[model samples]
Target: MTRHFSETEVVAILDDLNPARLRSFVAARVVTPLQTPQGQAFSEADLARLQLLCDLSEVYDLPDDALAMVMSLIDQLNTARGDMRALIQAVATEPDEVRGRIMTHVRSIRVTGRG
Candidate 1:
């Protein structure tokens, strides 16, 4: 099972992320945590993201709007990568003839720069 960190524990791990900054991240929709009756709990993914956010904030000095845009783009790219993996797996199951056709079409598109 994946480990979950409480709000306090997250702050402890990331010293730079004080309570207020963590709250700001949540408010900005950058690092979302799970809400439970006890309180908020962050998963490993959230922890990694929060760490990245802290690094970006400290190292790059990015403005709030710019940071949000960067994070949003990263999220989109991750989603696209997952979709690409699924598509590749689906294509892998095709018969050799079908796969050959797909390869031909793909190579044609690449060479001609058209679909």
Candidate 2:
């Protein structure tokens, strides 16, 4: 089962996560914790993200807009990495001839506008 952290627990774990800052993070959609009847329950991922947000806010002194942009770029990079991994796996499944052809096509595309 996944472990969940209450607001107090989150604050305890991350000293920088004050109530006001937590509210701001929620408003900014930076960390979407699960809402229970008790209160907001954060997952491990949420906690990690919150820690990063804290670092960005305190250390980098990034404003909300700038932080959002940085996070967006990070998300995009992660997505691209996953896509590249899947593509590599798919390529690995192909025959040697097919792989060679694909490499040639890729090289040609890099050298010229068209493959």
Can you write out model 2's per-residue Cα lDDT over 46-93, one digit (the tens) per residue? 899999999999998998778788888888999999999999999999
Clashing residue pair totals per candidate (backbone < 3 A): 0, 0
Error of 2 at 80 (Å): 1.1
Lowest lDDT block of 10, candidate 2 = 63-72
Show where candidate 1 strays beyond 4 Å: none
TM-score of each: 0.92, 0.90
How well does candidate 1 match the true structure in TM-score terms?
Answer: 0.92
lDDT of each: 0.92, 0.91
